[model samples]
Target: MDERTRADVERAEAALVEHYPRLVRLTYLVLPPSTGRHRRVLTAHGLVQRALPRARLRRPDGGLPAQRGPAAEPGYDVVRLRALRLALAYEGRPLWGPAALPQVWGLRLFPRVGGAEELALDQALSAVPAPVRAALGLWHLEGLDEDAARSVLARAGVEEPDAAQRAAAQLDRETETGAAALLNSAEFDPCTVQTRPTDLLRRRQRVRAALALVAVLAVGGAAAGLLSGDGDRTGRPPTTAEQALDPGRLLRTPNEAWTDTSRVDFTAWPVRGRQAGDRELLGRALRVWAAPPADARIMTSAGTSTRPPDHPPQLLYAGQIDAVTVVVFYDGERLVRYAEPEGATPTLHFARVDDADLTSGAALVIGRGNGWMRYLLAPWVSDVGVRDLLAPAGPVHGLHVTPDAVTDRIPVPPEGGTGCGHWPAAQFRPSTRIAGTGVNPPFLLTDLNDLVPVHLTSVPPGGAPAARAGEATGTPALQGWARTACSLGTLRGAGVRSVDNWAFAGQRLPEDSGSATWVCSRADTWRGPGSVTLHFLPPTTRPAEPGRIAGRARDTAACSSFGAPVVGNVHWRAQSGKWYLLAAGSHGVGGIDATGGVRVSGHTNTLAAPAGRNAPDEVVGRLRSGGTVRALRP
Candidate 1:
């Protein structure tokens, strides 16, 4: 290790030793078991041991540079929280469940304490919900003020403080004396020092055993690629259009629509006071794909005029050259183009898009927004190669592009599904035409199959089966078709949990799924019924060595963002049935608060830092070399 890092580790270790006693006391209080006090204490010790190596020590001012090793272990509270989560997970309870049940000894369980006192205490404490119990523990046991208690509760997923206050009052009335007695009990002393060398050695061995368990369970390999900070490109970025420059507006639509008409209704509008440079950039991005005829007039962007008054006016230009349609979008530095043939896919001779292709498009132009645009092109874009499009847009970031992005064809979806809204007519074909892109997107995917399928096992509240499925209720008609097409067996295999209608609608779909694209769009009742297009989705792409990093990383000061040092937790499960905690800390390096954790695996003794920021591979490397992984179980 370098002198600086070694020094930081030494300092942190010294702090760990100094704060070890207090850390144990806090863990015992937070996770007082109904029995087995000594065992629980040992577990808490191991958790702290494991957490320290991975923790980012906060300075007195709360800024992070764990190497500083402040006199006070700002990470003490973080250790307790991590311990609480570990205890809960070990016991198979919700990590955020109510504050621990009173840690009564043998006599209490066998009824040494007065029946009245025990009953009152049990009633009061158990009655307190998770947040309230946590609050009470912090206030009465830990002596934290209302604000501090509230902050802890909030981190534990409790938003409001009123409930905690109310529970505290209840505890005061019911078992104030009993609580005092429990605190003063001989079995629960927080200040007791463990001086026995043999006992300490034995405990250390147990901690090692726990670490072994984790290492055995952890998947071993290189880490997954770095995830993107920008969310999966499901929606367009906010436009920064200037409202003051109102030369001419484009075709404003209330909602987005996709139609077969190559040429949207286009009427030439004067550029009024628009900048020549802005116009030039727009032309270049479009010319790279397919240039419109010189006579083709530019139409105002659809839906800019009525954009919310607070939102930036959007600049969009649409034009047609015979069978080809070109639409350009500009939001300051960001520029996008939607180029496609009038009714058929275009044959592009260019192998890839580059900086020279689109002058200002360098690195700034994100390609995931061009979802399914690849299908419209011949000699489809390669998963790894499509990144070339962003060369002109600047540093090209990687994203998990769907097969439809490269080719329009997919395996024939099961019977009963149909295309809805502006979706093209369904064309049943083989899946080979659209092979899966075998990499996870840095951001999450919001594909059609990701939707939760509602099964009408029982009629829903406020409506019948057909009535319950409406436009406002998220493509119920398509959902119904999905329900019919997939039997209970299929749905179960597909991970669609069937619930009563109302409850189902309120639930969220899982982050990942293996089903194909199930398109549903709103239909105009007056014009005709909506459509539901179905395409066989590719197999689910599983991370090679799947793992998660539950922590924060440094976001970019600008583009080319990397996951800098962060304080968080890492967990991994491999195909070999290994599941283990890679690291735990209050301060984590490299921010990665995404859905699936970044993939990472390696020897517990050695660590690797990622080569680039925001790259999945970078995250894996950070976790590997970021800090020492303690064998102690979380």
Candidate 2:
């Protein structure tokens, strides 16, 4: 969580200047040479011209650190590095995978600049593709592991590039004797440079002086410590000895044993589900609850370590399920935490951790019924560690858990069939204890039975208007035609097909029974295992007519489906409810495809941003403020 100051960079520069010749030689190996004939863009003349000298450095101290190295050099051009990575990637060269690149480089030269060279290399990585270079540098240079690197590579989309024949040819030419010629060899150490005789002699003099001075200081410091009878703390301060430095240790670690998971596969992750019954909702919406595949891996993140890509992991995590969102959690590239809502109040999560679980960092707090489901998104992913990925606009989380953070498992008071084997909600004891500070966490109760169960009396076939469940009033019915065009991005959600517009209907009188209607599609709906639907309706409800939007805003479905026989129906029924006609307009069933066609999308992760489930093409309201209109069929 600590930030390196500009002064730290200056110190690195001085080190570079003091060791320019070797550094240049190292850089030269990476570079194709400055020969005029160089067309591979080893000629970084233009890019280096703009970038290098412009490079600036700062030290840990607020004041300036001595500068003479690349940090201080006017031009800290890294076009060569960028060019190198691009060439390797574009040409599909058999260089190290992105995650292990830096560490692999370290194998060639053990770094000893006391973090200076390493820091510079880390910075240089940004000049290239962030994911690839960072992953590679972390694996090759720093001491990350295979599990850590796998996470980085997945984020970078970099994999084992060369095949067997290519790899064999490359190995023959690179195996010790014929190594340096490979484009990605350690010969490219930017720090290694050609040196002049005079410069070499001066370098030797400086090195000798620096080493001699260090010896004198060490001996003097030892004598002083011995004479004073001072205690030694090894690398740590005495006051902090026995102090736990592993940030991960303090976290409420995942009961890895409790979670059932598997390796990540392109297709086998999503479980089979139903195409009939209440399976229909919206034109297309991602099945909210997904049972990860038994074969999916845990998405091993070795922080760019030695783990090879082909080696499958033991669990498929939320990130692997949804790549982009997961990267937001695994990458440590951000610093702040936010608690934006699916439909909750906004706040911030503030915490700075050097090494810790994502939950250990500041977590944006949120609340829903039953104290269940607190979704958080952290910013600055994967810089310090995988925990840095999720940064969103949420509340500022202090050091302790909030009331909303503690959720109780809802008890199964018998509306049920085949309950879970473990802690069944029916056995859970109710506690008068309030949630949060000093109180035991809330317990699950047959809480729903107390609230009026919404009733669904069919309206038969009628020409009426549609509104939020339990709040329909007189309005123009859906007219001629209303069709939203689906593009390649339309079905991009995880197994999402179309939007579902299902809710309870309110009659003119309060005493009348509430009815339900459904608007959905069956584009990508599948029938499989452990499928669940979560209604993440954050109460964005403004004052409706006289009071509040009284409809229950809770996700209410989680069961096995056997509806594939009715896939043609496109409409699914609800358990706590069923469908009837308010005023059916031009609502129909359809799906979008790739190339802006229909039914051409390959999978869900590739679905484009915001697939229009919550989007509204038009509005209908009373003749005045126009502020009270409800969003109709998504």
Predicted model with the maximum lDDT: 1
Best by TM-score: 1
| Candidate 2 accuracy as lDDT | 0.23
lDDT of each: 0.31, 0.23
Report model 1's TM-score to 2 decimal places. Answer: 0.23
lDDT of 1 by residue, 136-219 (tens): 556766677887777776665566766766767667666534465554343344344221112222333454476554543342
- List TM-scores for all candidates, in order: 0.23, 0.21
RMSD of each: 29.2, 24.3
Candidate 2, residues 301-370, lDDT tens digits: the string is 1111111112111111122111112211111211121222344332222111223321122222122233
Native-to-model Cα distance after best TM-score fit, residue 628 in candidate 1, in Å: 65
Worst window of 10 by summed lDDT in candidate 1: 220-229
325, model 2: CA deviation in Å?
30
Off by over 4 Å in 1: 1-16, 32-39, 53-73, 84-130, 159-162, 178-181, 190-634
